[model samples]
Each structure stands twice: as structure tokens, then as C-alpha cells.
Target chain A: MIEAIGVSKRYGETVVVDGVTLRLPRGGVTAIIGPNGAGKSSLLSMIARLLPMSAGQVRVDGLDVARTPGAVLAKRLSILRQDNHLPARLTVRDLVAFGRYPHSGGRPTREDAAHVERALRYLALEGLAERFLDELSGGQRQRAFVAMVLAQDTDYVLLDEPLNSLDMQHAVAMMRLVRRAAEELGKTVVLVLHDLNFASCHADHIVAMRDGRVLMQGSPAAIMTPEAIAAIYDVEATVHEIGGRLIAAYFA
Target chain B: MTAARDPRLVLAVLGALALGSAALFMTWGVNGAWGFALPFRAAKLATMLLVAHAVAVSTVLFQTATGNRILTPAVMGFDQLYVLVQTVLVFALGASAFAGLDRRLLFAGEVAAMIAFSFLLHAALFGGARRSLHLLVLGGVVLGVLFRSLAGFLQRIIDPNEFAFLQDRFFASFNSPHHGLLAIAAAMALAASLLGWRALRRWDVLSLGREVSITLGLDHRREVTRILVMVAMLVSVSTALVGPVTFLGLLVANLAHAVMPSFRHAHLLPAAFLLAVICLAGGQAVLEHGFGFDTSLRVIIDFLGGILFIALLVRGKVR
Candidate 1:
């Protein structure tokens, strides 16, 4: 279980993440959806220890993230940010193989090689394994990064805007991959997402934030109401129940 | 790729070139009696190889830490700092004081100052915030200008005779090895290289970017800081020994990358060092014998290296 207590992040005069305290349970997919500048990414960064919180503490399992050694936390939890620009040339295999760095450093053992192979196959990147990351298409690169995080073999995975550059087909496929990782692998997955319908259709729990505070948190059936959607986005979103899934239509 | 076209083969060729140059450097000063000439030339050869290794390794590490190809250790005002120290010594103690001062002490003082300045600069610029590479480079430029202006001001205030002595100190010369300082420099370089070897694997991961390195459990901030300190020490040693060859590092490191396309630091570091050795040793040999050039070898290196730097920038390969 990952827990944040009174997490707050302020930049100069503005408070980006205002006193957010929440618990993300184990072995499920939790999607954080918010409008622009809603502090969704800031909150995730704090939880992952990528950003220092102005005031708060985060605990993963029994270890305090702030006090824990980086390598230790890295072994248990992994995070992939939205934008990753590497300055050097690295192939997809090289990038994914780095996932085992905490365990093997740089020298790959037979076991580490097995993990890399499995992750490459899992992401359908076997054909592009040797291809440089810069040469791959946007969606392919996105999957390659995801495969790297998956190869880390962490129990808890935090991804910020994982589907940013992905097309519809790839986005749906990526979501299914997240779902399978949570369900079959028994790993806890937390992600910040923009598309409300995608979050509603796939997430086991929905966390809606507005202006740095949690507006609502519940199952999709409870948080997908017109009143809840309007309160969170400040715009009219018609919530429709189709195929037993609550889909929010905000396009119109 | 086949073994014939393998990039490793290119690295092997460069290594051979470095070795051949070392051999040439050792024998270049051989004269009527082999006994006396060989030791004198061998000392110079050792100094050249050490300085070459120091500059090449530091520049490559600096580029990796900054995540940019165009920046070198000189940009951080390290060489300018050395100049400032020399000028200050002349101003305070007079030209005659330089003859009495221990060369090793002077070298130590200069290196210490450079390392301290670098630490202070990095702390001020990057403390508690994300640092942009552009901003860091800009800060370096500003610092370089400030140090150079200060040194120039001191130079103006000194007597004409003292000014002449200071001027001689500024231009790079291969005639003097300062054997007293060589042992200390070699020891420090060896220690830094060992630490670097321990961190080599993580360095490859580090070049991938901060996010990936952090995700892989490497302490990105601590690791970068350590590398910067090592780079500062190495740069100080090289600049103190041979004055400053600003473009030699940029030329060699880029050549290494062009020749060996591997991202692995294990290969890249050796290739870069070998490239530097070949450039420095071979250029010195040619300047002394092949061309019979009476000028300092630094002039030849700077000329070629400056042109290569411009070409690299024009090709847009330095991003």
C-alpha cells in the first residue's frame, strides 16, 4: 500500500499541490484525473519522491520514502514520467536492460537477461528490441518506456500521463496492458490520465482533483455522475451508462 | 556488422595510434648519447600522456553530466581560474618569487582553487532546483569573463618585467615537464580514474537522463556531484601541466563518438583517452621533428582543434 499524508507543494506564491492525503490500495489500477494545472502530476511526482513536498510524508509498504535509500525504493516502486528525453543514443534493449540496474548494476546475469526478454515480449517490442529509441515512432517509444518500467519488476508502478503521445489503438492497448499487470501480476498501478472516459472505463478507482485538492474519490459508478463531473471540471459533462460502463461525454 | 567493419576495430586502431605516438614521443629527443636524452624525453612523454588522459576524461565526463556535447571543462572557467592564480602570484610576490616557489606547491594551490570554485558554482546554480543546461553554460560564460577580466586587470598593474614573466607563464610550452609536480598529478589522476571505473556502468545509465537513472535506483544528484568533482580535479591537473588546450578535449571526445558509435562508457572512455594521446603525442612529435616548427606545439593543436570545433558546430552534431 502507498499512502500520502498531508502532502503539499508550493512554488513561490502559488500552491500547486495543496494538502493532499490519500491511500492507494494494493493490487489495482487507480487513475487520477484532473483538468489542466490541477496538480495531478505534482502529486504523483511527490509520491514517487521525484519532487520534494513542501510539507508531507509518503510511505510505501512500511518504508518511508523520504528516509529510504533510493536503490531500496527503486526496487519496490518504479515511476515513468510523461516526457523522457535522453541525450545519448540507446537502443530499446539497452533502455529496458537498465531496469535491472538496481539488481545487477550494469553486468547482466542470465536471470537479468530473462527479465529483459520477458519485458520486450510483453510489450510486443521483440522486433524493435535492437532499434534505437530515437528511430522508433512515438507510440512505439511510449511502449518501449513502459516496457522498461515493467522490466523493473517493482510491486508498485506510477506512471504520469503514460498515454500522452499514443493514438487510440495504442492507448487502448496500453490501458489493457496496465490492467493485466494489475490483475494478473498482482501489482499496484497508479497513473495520471486526461481522458475521463478512458479513466472511467478502465480504472478500478477514480480520483478527481480540482485546483490542487481532491474533489471526489470513489468507484467509477459513484464519481461518473453529472454533478460530480461538473464539480470537478467546471464544465457540463453528460455521464451516460453504456454497456454497464459510465462514460463521460465532454466533447460536445 | 562484420568484424572488419566493427566499431571496436576502429577503437583498436585508435589505441594503436596512441601507442605509436607514445613510442615516437619517447625517442624524439634522442641525441648523441642515448643515456642522458632518453630519460629527459621519457619524462616529457609521461607528462604529455598524463595531461592528455586528464583532459580527455574530464571533458567527456563533464559533457555527460551536463547532457550536452558542446560544453567542455574550460567553459566552466577552470583554465581561466588557473590564469588568475598565476597572475595573482606574480602581483603579490614579484617575478623573482616564482623561481623560489615550489612547483608542486603552486600546482596544488591552483588545483585546490579550481575544485573549490567549481563546487561553489555548482551549489549556487543548482541548489534545490532543477538546473537547465543552457543556464549552466551561461553561468560558466559569465564566470569565465569575470575571471579573465580580473586577471587582465592584475596584469596591467604589474611592472613591465613582471608582466613579461607572467606572459611566458600564459603560453603553453612542452619544454618543461615540472617533474616535481608530475608524481602528485599522476597519483591524483589514478585515484580519480579508479573511482570513475567504479561508476562507469552507472554513467551509461546516467547519460540516458535523470528520470531513467533515478528509476533505476541510482542516486542521480549524488552521482552527478561526484562526477563533477572528479572532472574538476582532472581538468585542473591537465590545465596546470600544459596550460590550457581548450579545443583539444572537444576535438578528441567528438572524434571518439564519431568513430565508436557505442553508448557504453566502458568503451567510450578508453577510446576518448586514446584519441587524446594520439593527438597530443603525435602533434608534439610532428611539431618538433616533421615540420621543424619553432613555435609551441599548443599552437598547432589549437589551430586544428579550433577548426574541427567550428565544423562540428556547423554540422549541428553538438546538441
Candidate 2:
């Protein structure tokens, strides 16, 4: 389990993530949904130790993230940010292979190769594994990045805005892959999502944040009420039961 | 598999060409005094090779660390710092007093000052604030301008004869290296090269960017700091050896990247070093023989290297 206690981040005079305390369970999909400048990405970054928190502590599996060695924490947890621009020319397979760095330290063993292949196969990227990441389409590149995180095989996977450039079909497919990873691989998946319907349909738990603090967090059934949606998003969202899923409709 | 073809054979051929060039450099003046002429030219040859290797390796590593092709150790105000140190020495103690100073002591002083400056700059800029790399580059440019202006101010105040001596020291001059500084520079370069080789594997991961490197379990801050220190030391040695050759490193590092066509630093580093040596040695040979010794080899290299740098910038090959 990943736990954040009184975690806060301040940039100069402004507080970006203010006093966020939450516990992400061991195995399931948890979605953090919020508006722009809601500090969702900042919270995720602090949890991953990508951005240092100004106050409070974060622990992963009882190991203090700030105090623990990076290598040890990296084996247990991995994170993928929204924008990843690399200067080197790398193929999809090569990028995926880097996921084993914490284990093999860049010298790949036979088992590492097997893991890479499995990740590529899981993402349906086996055919495009050898192609350069720059040559692939936007959706394909997004899948390749997901494959890399899956190849890491960490217990806790944190993805910040993973659906940024993805189309609807690919976004659904990506969420399904995340759900599968949680269900089959028994991994804890936390993602920052924008679309309420997708979060309602896919996530086991939904966390709503407004301004650097959690507005509400519970099952989709509990947090999908019209009053709660309006309170968090400041828009009248009519909650309706569609295909046994509580979907939020706010457009028009 | 074909893409992964080992560059060892190509490296061997380049090594052979270097050796052949060295042999020619040695025998080109064989009929002169054996003791004085041969050893003097040999000292020049050794200094050239060492400086070339040092600059090439440090520039490539710097580019990898910064994730930009155009920025080099020079861009970080390293060469500017060297000039500042020289100008300060001359201004404080007068040219004659500075001339009387021990060459080894002077070299050590220059290297120590540069290392300290680099550490201070990195720590100050990247320590607290979450500033971007571009900000750091901007700071470096500002510092470079400040150092150059201060050095120029000191230059203007010095006596005419002293100014002449200082001017000679400013421009790169391989033909007249202080032989006493050669051994110390070689040792420093060798130690840095060893450290760089040990970290070669991590360098490939670092080139992927910060988030990936962190996710891969490499401590990004620690690795970048260590690489920066090594780069500073290497640049100091090369600049102290033959003065500053600003664009040679840029020219060679980019050429190596273009020729190697791979992201792996294991092959790229050696290729860069060899390319540097070949360029320096061959350029010197042609300047001495083909050009009838009419001009300094530094002029030729700077001319070509400057053109290549401008071309790279115009073509947007920097990032």
C-alpha cells in the first residue's frame, strides 16, 4: 500500500498541493479526477518522489519514499508522467527493455528479455516492437509507454494523465489494460483522469479534488451523485444509470 | 542484429590511421637534432592528442547530460573561467611576476578554481528552485559574458608588453605547449576517463530524460553532479594544455554522433575520442606539410569548426 500523510507542496509563495493525506490500497484501480490546476498531477508526482514535498511524508509498503534508496523504491513502485521527450533515438522494444534497469542494471538477462516480450505482447505491440517510437502513431506511442511501465512489474503504478493525446477508443482500451493489470497482475494502479464517465465505468474508487484538497472520495456509486458532482466540478452533472454504470452527463 | 554490428573493426582502422599519422609527425623533422627536435615535437604531439581526447569526451558527456547537441562544456563558462583566471593572475601580480610563477603550480591553481566554480554554479542554480535546464543555460551565458567583460577590462589596463604576452596566451597555440604541464594533464585525463567509462551504462539511461532515469532507479541529481565535476576537470586540463579550442569539441562530438548512428555510449564515447584525435592529428599534419607551415593549425580548426557549428544551428540540429 502507498500512503501519503499531510503531504503538501509549495512553490515560492503559492501552495500547489495542500495537505493531501490518502492511502491507496494494495491492489485495485483508483482514479484521481479533478479540474485544471487541481493539483492532481502534483500529488501524483510527490507520491512518486519525482517532486519533493515541502511538508509531510509518503511511505510505500512501509518504506519511507523520501528516505529510502531510489533503487529499492523503484523496484516496488514506478511512475509515468504525461510528457516524455527523449533526445536519443530509441525503438519501442528498447524503451520497454529499460524497464528492467532496476533489476538487471542495463545488462539484460534472458529473463529480462522474456519480460520485455510479455509486456509487448500484453499491449498488442509485438508487431511494432522493433519500430522507433518516433515513427509510431500517437496511440501506438502511448501504448508503448504503457508497455514500458508494465514491463517494470512494480507493485504500485502511478500514471499522471496517461490519456492525454489518446482518442476515445484508445483511451477505453488503455483503461481496460490498466484494469486488467490491477485484476490479473494484482498491482495497485493510480491514474489522473479527466473524463468522468470513464472514471465512473472503469475505476474501483474515485477521488475528486477541487483546489489542492480532496473534495470527495468513495466508490463510483457513492461519489457519482448529482450534488457531489456539482459541488466538485461546479457544473450540474445529471447522474444516470446506463448499462449498470453510474454515468455523469453534463454537456448541454 | 545488423544494426548492432560492433564498431571495433572500424575503431581499429581509425587507431591505425592515428598511429600512422603519429609516425609521420615524428619523422617529418627527423634530419634535425635527434635529442632536442624529436622530443620537442613529441611533446607537442602528446599534448595535442591528450587535449583532443579530453575535450571530445567531456563535450559528448556534457551533451548527454544536458540532452542537447549544441551546448558543450564551453557553454557553461568553463573556457571563460580559464581566461578570467589568466587575466586575474596577470592583473594582480603583473606579467613578469606571473611569468616567474611555477607552471605546474599555475596549472593546478587553474584546475582547482574551475572545479570549484563548476560546483558552485551547479549547486546554486539547481539546488533549491525547480528551475528548468534552459534557465541554467541562460545563467551560464550571463556568467560567460560577465567573465569575458572582466577579463577584457583587465586586459585593457595592462602594459603593452605584458598585453602582448597575455594575448599570445589567449589564443590556442599547440606548437608551443608548456611541456612541464603535460604529465599532470595526462594523469588527470586518464583518471576522469576511467570514471566516465564506469558510468557509461548509466549515461544511456540518462539520455532518455529525468523521469525515465529516476524510474530506472538511477539517482539523477547525484549522477548529474558527478558528471559535471568530471566534465569541468576534463575541460580544465584541455584548456590549460593548449589554451581554448572552443568549437573543435562541438564539431567532433556531433560528427561522432552522426557517424555512429547509435545511442549507446559504450561505442559513442570511444568513437568521439578517436574522431577528435584524427581531426587534430590530421589537421596538424596538413597544416604543417600541405599548407607549408604558413599558418597556425588552430586557425584552420577554428575556421572549420566555427562553420560547422553555425551550420548545425541554422539547420536546427541542436536539440
**lDDT values for all models:** 0.84, 0.84
Model 1 misplaced regions, further than 4 Å: B1-8, B26-37, B89-106, B128-132, B159-165, B175-180, B294-297, B307-319
The sequence of per-residue lDDT tens digits that candidate 2 reaches over residues B51-165 is: 8888888998888877778778776677888889888888888889888998768777877788788888777865775566557667877888898899999899889888998
- lDDT tens digits by residue: candidate 1, B243-280: 77777888888887767767878878888999988988
DockQ of each: 0.64, 0.60
DockQ of 2: 0.60
TM-score for each of the candidates: 0.93, 0.92
